[model samples]
Target chain A: DVKVTQSSRYLVKRTGEKVFLECVQDMDHENMFWYRQDPGLGLRLIYFSYDVKMKEKGDIPEGYSVSREKKERFSLILESASTNQTSMYLCASSGIRDGGYTFGSGTRLTVV
Target chain B: AQTVTQSQPEMSVQEAETVTLSCTYDTSENNYYLFWYKQPPSRQMILVIRQEAYKQQNATENRFSVNFQKAAKSFSLKISDSQLGDTAMYFCAFMKLISGYALNFGKGTSLLVTP
Candidate 1:
C-alpha cells in the first residue's frame, strides 16, 4: 500500500528550541507538502517541494523552513519554536498526474 | 486569491441517515478542481470525493457523493447511510493551476454520527 509516514506522532518542545518533523513517502510522488492545523484556521500550508532540493513558501511560512534532500523525504523545521506554534502538523504527497493528495498521520506538537 | 469556505462548523447525523455538508469557493478561474477530504480522530486525512469544473457529472465514492455547481462555484458532499466510522472533520478544498498545485482548504466541518 502507498503511504506517507511522519517520523513523530506527538512532540513537546521547549520554547526557543529548534524542532524537526520528518515525512517520507514510498509512492515516488513528486510533490510533498507540510501544513499546520489549528482549531479555526483549518490547515495552513507552510511549505511544499516539487522536487528534490526545491521548495516554495506557502501561506504561513513564517518561523518555518523546509528541507527536501531526496525525492521521497521532506522535513519541516521550526527555527525557534514558540508557544504560539503549538498545533497539529500534517505531511502530504501527491503525484503530478494525481489531482488529490495522500496524507500521513499528523504530528501534534506542543511548544511550551 | 482563491478561498474555500465551509459554512457549517459542526453537524450531527444519526447513523444510517443521509447528510449533506455545504462548501463554496471564490475564484475567477474557469477551470479548476474541488475536493472533499475526511480527517478522522486518528488524524489521517483521506480524500472522500472530487469534482472537476468541466465535468457535469458529480463524483461519487461508495456512500459519498458531491453536488457540483460550476456556475455557482459550489461543491457539497453528501453522505448516505452514514456509519459510526464516518464521523470526522471534513474539509473542502480548491485547486487550480494558477494556485501552483497547492490546495486552499476551508475551515472544515466537524461531523458526529450518533446512534
Candidate 2:
C-alpha cells in the first residue's frame, strides 16, 4: 500500500512565527502537492512540485512557500504565521497515471 | 481554467438506502480526469471513484457508482446500501492531465447516514 506521512498531526504557534509542515511519500511519486482545507471552501491548492527542485504555484499561494529537495519529500513553509492561516493542511502524492492522488492524514494548525 | 461545483451542501440517507450527490464542472481541456473523494472525521482524504473524460463508460467501485454526462459536463456519485461509515464530506475534483497542474476541488457536500 502507498503511504503518505505528515510530520505533525496537530500544531500550535504564535503569530509572526515561522512554521514548517513536512510530508514524505514512499511511493516515489513524481508529483507532490500541498493544500489548505476550510469549511465551505474545500481544498485549495497552495503549491505543488512535479519533480525534485521543481515547484509551481497553485491558485492560492500567497503567504506560503514550498521546498522539494528530494523526490520523496515535500515541505510547506509559512514565513510568518497569522491567525487567518489556521486551518487543516493536507499533503498528497500522485503518479502519471489517472491522476490518482494518495493523501496524508492532514495536519490541523492553529495560530494564536 | 477548470472548475468543479457540488450543488448540494448537505445530504442525508438512511441505512441500506441509496443516495446521489450532484457534481458539475467546467473545463476546456479535452482529456482530463474527475474524482470523488471522501474526507471523514478522521481527516484523511480517500478516493472514492474516478472517471476519465475520454471514456464513455461511467466508473463504479462496489456500492459506489458515478453517472457521467460528458456533454452536460456533469459527474454525480450514487452510493447504494449506505452505511454509517459512509458519512463524510464528499468533494468533487477536476484535474487536467498536464504538467504543473493540480486538482481543482468543489466546495464539498456533507453526507450524513442515519440508521
Candidate 3:
C-alpha cells in the first residue's frame, strides 16, 4: 500500500508562532503538494514541489511557504501563524502525472 | 481558471442500493484527467475513480463506475450496492496539465449510507 505520513494530526499554536507541518511519502514520487481544506472553499493548493529543490505557489500561497530539501519529505511552514490560517492541512504525492494523488491523513491546525 | 463543481452537498442512500453523485467541471484543456476522491472521517483522501478525457469509455473500479459526458463537461460517480463503508465526503477534481500537475477540487459532497 502507498503511504503518505503526516507528522501531526492535530496542532494548536499561539498567534505569531512559526509552525511546521511535515509529510513523508514512501512511494518515491516526484510530486508533493500541500493543500488547505476549508469548510466551503474545498481544498485549495498552497505549494507543490515537482522535484527535491523545486517548488511552485498554488492559488492560496499568501500566508504559507514550503520546503522540499529531500525527495521523500515535504514540509509546510507558516512564518507567522494567524487565526485565519487555522484549517485542515493536507499533504499529497503523485508520480509524474495526474492519475491520482495519495494524501496524508491531514493535520488540523488551530491558531489562537 | 479551471473549476470543479459538486452540486450535491449532502446525499443519503440505503445500504445494498445504488447512489450517483453529480459533478460538473469547467476547463478548456482538451486532454485532461477527472477524478473522484473519497475523504472519510479519518481525513485520508482516497482516489475512488479516474477518467481520461481522451478515452471514450468510462472508468470503473469494482462496484464504482463513472458516467463521463465530455460534451456536457460532466462526470458522475455511481456506486452499486452501496455499503456503509461508502459513506464519506466525495470530491470531484480536475487535473490541469499546465505548469505543475495539480488537482483543482470541488467543495465535495457528504455521502451517508444507511443500513
- Alpha-carbon shift of residue B50 in model 3 (angstroms): 0.5
- The Cα error of candidate 2 at residue A25, in Å, is 0.6
Best by DockQ: 2
Q: Rank the candidates by DockQ, best first.
A: 2, 3, 1
Residue lDDT tens for model 1, B1-115? 4889999999999999999999999999988889999999888898998888889999999999999988888899999999999999999998886423788899999999999
Task: State which candidate has the highest TM-score.
Answer: 2
Q: Ignoring the other chain, what TM-score does chain B have in each prediction? A: 0.96, 0.97, 0.98
Model 3 chain A poorest ten-residue lDDT run: A93-102
The DockQ values of the predictions, listed in order, are 0.62, 0.77, 0.73
Per-candidate Cα RMSD to the true structure, in Å, reads 1.1, 0.9, 1.1
| lDDT (tens digit, per residue) of candidate 2 on B9-90 | 9999999999999999998888989999999999989999989899999999999999999989999999999999999999
For candidate 3, lDDT tens digit of each residue in B18-85?
99999999987899999999999888898999999999999999999999999999999999999999
Off by over 4 Å in 2: none
- Which wins on DockQ, candidate 1 or candidate 3? 3
Off by over 4 Å in 1: B98-100
Q: Write the per-residue lDDT of candidate 3 for residues A25-107, one digit (tens) a residue.
A: 99999999999999978899999999999999999999888999999999999999999999999999998874678899999
CA shift of A56, model 3, Å: 0.9
